[model samples]
Target: MEELAINGGPRIRLKELPSRRDIGSEEMKELVDVIWSGNLNRVGGTKVSAFEKEFAMLYGVKHGVASTSGTASIHVALGAINPEPCSEIITGPISDIGSIVPILWQNCIPVFADVDPETYGLDPEDVERKITDRTVAVIAIHLFGQCCDMDPLLKICREHGLYLIEDASQAHLAEYKGRLAGTMGDLGCFSLQQSKQMTCGDGGITITSNDELAERARLFADKAWPRGQAGDRGYLFLAMNYRMTELQGAVALAQLRKVQDIVARRRRVGDTLTKLLSEVEGVNPPKILPGVKHSYWLYPLTIDTGIIKATPEEFARAVSAEGIPASTGYIKRPLYMFSILKDQATYGSSHCPFDCPRYNRRIQYKEGDCPNAEKVLRELITIPVNEFYTDEDVNDIFRAISKVARYYRENPKA
Candidate 1:
C-alpha cells in the first residue's frame, strides 16, 4: 500500500451540498409567490392544502398534516394518541435524539431498545421485552434509509394494543415487504430537513390512515383549532403551534415531484460504491435486509477492527486528506445515557412520568447496554452518497477508501 500525501484537506466541504433551488426551482418559485400573497396558515390555503393532499396521495394515507419539524410531528402524533403521562414508548436508543425527544416532550417515558446489528433498526425482540402494561406506543425508526423488520414489530404492537408510530425521517420512500415505510404504521412522520433526501429547508409531515388520528394531529399542531375553521377563535384545546409555512409547503411540494429521480440517483451511487468497496479488505458495505428498498440516505461501511491497524477516526482523516468526505462514529448513543436524562435537575426526578423507580434507575444504560451498537459506533465509517456524485466522483471515493483500507492492513503499529 502506497501512502499518499496526508495533508489536512476536505474532499468535499459541507457547504457544497446540492442546491434545492436547482433541483426544484419551479415549485420554489410558486411557494415564494404564495408567501408573497401573505397566506401561510393551514386553513383555507391552497399551497398548504394542495401539498398535504398530494403528499397523502403519494403515501396512500388518508390524511397528511404538515408540521414545523419532524420532532413536532412526533409530538403531535403522540399528543393525538393522548397516552397517559409517564407511559412508556419503546424505541431504539441508537437513532437521532429527535426520534425520542417527542416522547419526553409528551410527558411520557422513553424505553430504550436495542437495534439489529445489520439493519441498525429497532430489534423487535428487544422491543417485546421492554413492553409492559404502561407501554402505550412503539416508535419504530427506519434508520439510515433502511426499513426495520416491521412484520414482527407490527405484530407486537397489535398484540399489546400499543399505538405504532413510524419515524420515517430517514427512510423517505423506502419499502419493506412490498409496503411503503410511512404507510405501514398507524401514524408516520417524515423530515424534510436540509439533509434528508427531499427538503423544504426544514419541515415535516405526519400521515395516518385513521381520520380521527389525523384530525387529532391537526388540532394538536394548530393549537386545537376546530376543523375547517380558518380564523382564530380563542382556541379549543391545549396545543402548540407546529404548523408549516406556505413557503416551506411549496418547496416541499416541488421536491416531492422529483423524489423518484433523486432516490434513483442515490441508489445508483450506492450500488457503485458498494460493488467497488466490497472487494477491499476490512471494509463491509452496509447490509440490505431482504424485502427492503433502501433510499441510501448515508452510505455506511463497517471496518473489521481486528484487521484494520488504524482507528475509525484515523481512517476517516486519511480518506478526507485524500479529498473524499468520510466520517466515523455512530450518530449518537441511546437517549437515556445522555446527561440530560441522567441529571434529574434538567427535567427533575419527578419529570419521568412513570413510577417504575427500579426500572428508571436500573434501566439506565451501562457502558455496554447494547454491545453491537457500541461496536458499530467504534468501527463504522461513512461516506457521502448523494444525488450529486458523478461517475468520476464515485470512482474517486472508491479509490480513496480502498487505499486507506489497504494502508491500514499493510501497516501494523506495534
Candidate 2:
C-alpha cells in the first residue's frame, strides 16, 4: 500500500449547510409578512390551518397537527395513544434521544431492539422478540432519511395490537414501497429544524389517519384542553404547552413546497459521494435497501477498522483537518446507558420493570442487543448531504476522502 500525500494538506469540508430561507426567499418573505400582520398562534389562524392541511395532503394522511418541535410531536402522539404506565415501547438504539425521551416522559418503558445492518432501521425480528404482554407500541425511526421496511414491521404491530409511531424527523418526503414514510404507521412525526431538508427554524408536525388521534394530539399539545368545546376555555387535562407558533407554521408551509426539490438535490449529492467512497479502501457507504427511496439527510460511511490503520476518530479528525467537517460517534448510547436512568430524581430507581440496579450498574452491552447499531456507530463517519453542496463540493469531498483513505492504508503505524 502506498500513501497519497497532499502538497497543501486535506482539502474537503465536512458540512456546508444551505440556507433554508435562501431556497424560498419569496415564500419566506410572504410568511414574515403574515407574521408581521399579527397572527402567531395555531388557534384560529390561516397560516397554521393552511400548513396543516397542505402537510397532511402531502403525506397522504387524513389530518396533520402542527407542534412546537419533533420531540413535542412525539410527546403529543404518544399522549394521544395514552399507553398504560410501564407499557413497553420498542425502538432502535441508533436514533436521537428525543425519540425515546418521549416514551419515558409518558411514563412508558422503552424496549431497545437491534436494527437491520443494511437498513439501519428497526428489525422486525428483534422487535418481535422484545414484545411482551406489556408492550403497547412500536416507534420505527426512518434513520438517515430512508424509510424502514414497514410491511413486516406493520404486520408485527398489527398482530400484537401495537401502535406503530413513525419517527420521520430525518426522513421528510422519503418513501418505502411506494408509500410515504409517516403515513404507514399509526402516527407520523416530522421535524423542521434548521438542518432538516424542510425547516421552519424550529417546528414539527404530527400526522395520523385516525381522526380521534389527530384531535387528541391537538388537545395534548395545547394544554390538554379539548379544542372547540363549549363554555370552558380553561385547560382541562394535564398537558404541557407544546403549541407551534403561526410564524413557524408559515415558514414551514413555505419550506414544504420545496421539499421535493431539496430531497432530489440531496440524493444527487449522496449518490455522488457514495460512488466516490466505494472506490476508497476501507470505506463503505450505506446500502440502500430495496423498495426504498432514500432522501439522504446525512450520508454515513463506515470505516473498516480491521483493514484501515486509522481509527474512526482519527479518520474523522483528519477529514476535518482537510477542511471537511466530520464526526466519529453518535450521542450517548440507548436511554438505559444514561445517568438519568440511575438518578432517583428522574423515573426513580425502581421504576424500571427489569432489575433496576443491575440494569443501571451494568455498562457492558450484550452482543446482539443492538448489534448492527453498535457496529455502525463504532465505524461510521457521517458527512452532511444537505442541499448546499454543489457538484464541485462533492468532487472535492471525494478527492479528500480518497487521499486520506490511501494515506492510512499505507501508513499502518500512524
Candidate 3:
C-alpha cells in the first residue's frame, strides 16, 4: 500500500486542480453595451430588464424580478408573498443563512425542519409535523443544487393553504419529477454569486408564473414604487430597494445564456465523481434522489467512522494533504445553532420576531432541533466541483480520496 500523504509520503496530486470560472467576451460585450448606453440603473437600463425577461423565458415563467443578492431574492419573494408579520415560515436546516435571514427581516418566525438523510433536503414528514396555525408559508430550499421532494411538499402546502417558495440559489437547472427547481413553487429564488454555476459577481433573481405575485415581486424589489405607472410616485407598501445594477445585469445576461451548458458540464463532473467513489469503502457519494438531477454546486460526501476509523474532519484533512481540497461540515453547525437564531440577536436585543407581541408564543431554537441535519453535518465532507475540471482533475481527486480512505482503513486508528 502507498504511504499516506499526511504522514510525509508523496502527494497523490502534484499540481493544482482547475478553479477558473467561465467568463469571457460574451460578458465583456454586454458590459460594453451597458457602459455605452450610460444607464447603470435598472429603472431605465436595458440589460437588467432584458436579463429578467430572458431568465423568466428560460424557466417558462411569466415574470423575473432581479435583485442585488441571493438574500435579496428571497426577501423579494417574501415581500411578494406578503405574509402576516410574525407568521411562521418553515424551511430546511442545512443551508446558507440567506434562506433564513429574510424571514427575520420580514418579522416572521423562522422555523427549521430537519433534512432527509439521503437527499439532504427538507423532509416532508418533518415539515408537516412542524406546522402550526401560525404557519403561512413553506420555503423549500433546494440545498446543494438538488431539488427537494416537492410532490409531498406541494401536497402538504396545498392542504394546509400554505404558500411554497423555492430557494434554488444553488440549483440553477436542477430538476425533480419533470419540474425545474424554481418553477415548482409559488415563487422561486436564485443566486448569481461568484461561486454559483453561473454568476454576475453578486446578484439574484426571483421568478413566478402567478401574475399578481410577479408584479408584487417586481415592485417589492424596487421599494414598492411602481416605476412604469405614469405620474404615479405612489409608494405602495413596506418594501426594500434590492434592485440589480446595470453592470451586474450585463454579466448576468451573458452568464444566463451559458448557464445551461455550465450546469451540464458540472453535472458530468459530479456524476463522474459519484460513480468513481461508489465502491470506495467507507466513503459515500451524494445520494441523488429518483427523478432528481443535481447541478453539482459543491460535491459533498460522507465518511463512515465505523469502517474508515476516522472522523469526517480527520478524513477531510488527510484528503486535503494529498492535494485535493476537502472540508468537513458545510456550515460547521446547523444555522439555528448560530447566535443569530439561538440567541435572538435581531434588532438590537429587541428580538422582535421571536419575542414580538405580534407573535403569541415565545420562539426558541436550540441543538437537536434537527437531528438528521446535525448528524449529516458531523459526517459530511465537501470537495469543490467546477465546470472547468478536466478528466485528469477528477481522477486526481479520486486518487487522493482513495489513498486517504485506504490508509485509514488499514491503520484502523489513524
Candidate 4:
C-alpha cells in the first residue's frame, strides 16, 4: 500500500483547480451602459427593472422583486405574505441563516423541521408533525442546489391553507419533476452572491405569480412607497429599503445570459464526480432524488465512520493534503444550535417575536430539535465543484478521494 499525503507522501494533484467564473466583456458591456447612464438606483435606472423583467421571464413567473441580498429577498417574501405576528414559519434546519432571519424580522416564529436523511431537505412528514394552528407558511429551502420533495410539501401546505415559499438561494435553475425549483411554490427567492451560479457580487430577487403577492412584494422592497405616483408621499406600511442597485442588476443581467450553460457544465462535473466516488469505498456522494436535477453549488459527501475508521475532520484533512480543497461539517452545527436561535438573541434582550405577549407560548430551541439535520452535519465533508473543471481535473479529484479512502481501508486503526 502507498503512504497517504498527510503522512508526508507524494500528492495526487500538483496544481490548483481551474477558475469557476467567466466574467469578461459581456458583464463589462452592461456595466458601461449603467456607468454612462449615471443612474445607480433601480427607481430611476433601467438596468434593475430590465433585469427583474428578464429574470421573471426566465422563471416563467409574473413578477420579480429585486433586493440588496438573499436575506432581503426572503424578507420581501415575508412582507408580501403579511402574516399576523407570532405566526409560525416552518423550514428545514440545514441552511444559511438568511433563510431563518426573515421570519424573526417579520415578527413570526421559525419552526424547524428535521431534514430527509438522504436528500438533506425538509422531510415532509416531519414538517406535517411540526405544523400548528399558528403556522402560516413553509419556507422550503432547497439546500446545496437540489430541490426538496416538493410534491408532498405542496400537498401539505395546500391541505393546511398555508403559504409556501421556496428559498432557492443555492438552487438556481434546479428542477424537480417537471417544474423549476422556485415555480413550485407560492413565491421563490434567489441569491446572486459571488459564489452562486448567477452572480452580481451580492443581490437577490423574489418571484411570484399571484397579482396581490407580486404587488405587495414590489412595494415592500421599496419601503412600501408607491413608485411613479408623483406628489404622493404616503408610506403604505412597515417595510425595508432593500432595493437592488443598477450596478448589481447590470452584472446580474449579463450573468443571467450564461447561467443555464454554467449550470449544465456544473451538472456534468458533479455527475462525473458522483459516478467516480461510487467506486470508492465508504464515502457517500450527495444523494440526488429521482427526477431531480442538482445544480451542484457545492459537492458534499459523507463517510461511514465505522468503515472509514476516521472522523470527517480527519478524512477532509487527508484529502486537502493531497492538494484538493475539502472541509468537514458545512456549518459545524445545525441552525437551531446557533446562539441567535438557541439563546433567543435578538431585539436587545427582548427576543421580540419569541417573547412577545401575542405569541403567548413558551417556545424553546434546543439541541435535539432536528436530530436528522445534526447527524448529517456530523458526517458531512464538503469539496469544491466548479464549472470549468476539465476531464483531467475531475480525474484528479477522483484519484485524491479514492487514494485517501483506500489508505484508511488498509489502515483501519490509523
TM-scores of the candidates in the order shown: 0.91, 0.90, 0.99, 0.98
Candidate 2 weakest lDDT stretch, 10 residues: 358-367
lDDT of 1 at 217: 91
**Local distance difference test, candidate 2:** 0.79
Q: Rank the candidates by lDDT, best first.
A: 3, 4, 1, 2
- lDDT, each prediction: 0.80, 0.79, 0.93, 0.91
RMSD of each: 3.1, 3.5, 0.9, 1.0
Q: Which stretches of candidate 1 lie over 4 Å from their true place?
A: 7-24, 229-234, 348-363
**Alpha-carbon error at 357 in model 2, in Å?**
16
Q: Which of the two, 2 or 3, has more lDDT?
A: 3
Instruction: Compare the candidates by lDDT and give the number of the best one.
Output: 3
What pairs collide in candidate 2? 10-322, 12-323, 12-324, 13-323, 13-324, 13-325, 14-324, 14-325
| lDDT (tens digit, per residue) of candidate 1 on 1-414 | 365436433343232434333355677587777877888765656777788899899888899989888888788889789886678888877777788788877777787778888778888998999898778999999988888899999999999999999999988888898898889989999988888888887899999999899889988988886765577675777788898988788888888888878888888888888899889889888888898888988888887778888888888888877777788876745566676564422455554534445335333545567677767777778876678877877888888888778878887541
Residues 23-56, model 4: lDDT tens digits: 8899999999999998888878998889999999
The candidate 1 region of ten consecutive residues with least summed lDDT is 13-22
**Candidate 3 per-residue lDDT over residues 325-360, each given as its tens digit:** 998899989999999999989898587878888788
Task: Give the poorly placed runs of model 4, Cα more than 4 Å off.
Answer: none
lDDT of candidate 2 over 78-149, digit per residue (tens): 988988766778888887778877887876667788888766888899999989877899999999899988
Least accurate stretch of 10 residues (summed lDDT) in model 4? Answer: 405-414
Residue 105 local lDDT, model 3? 92
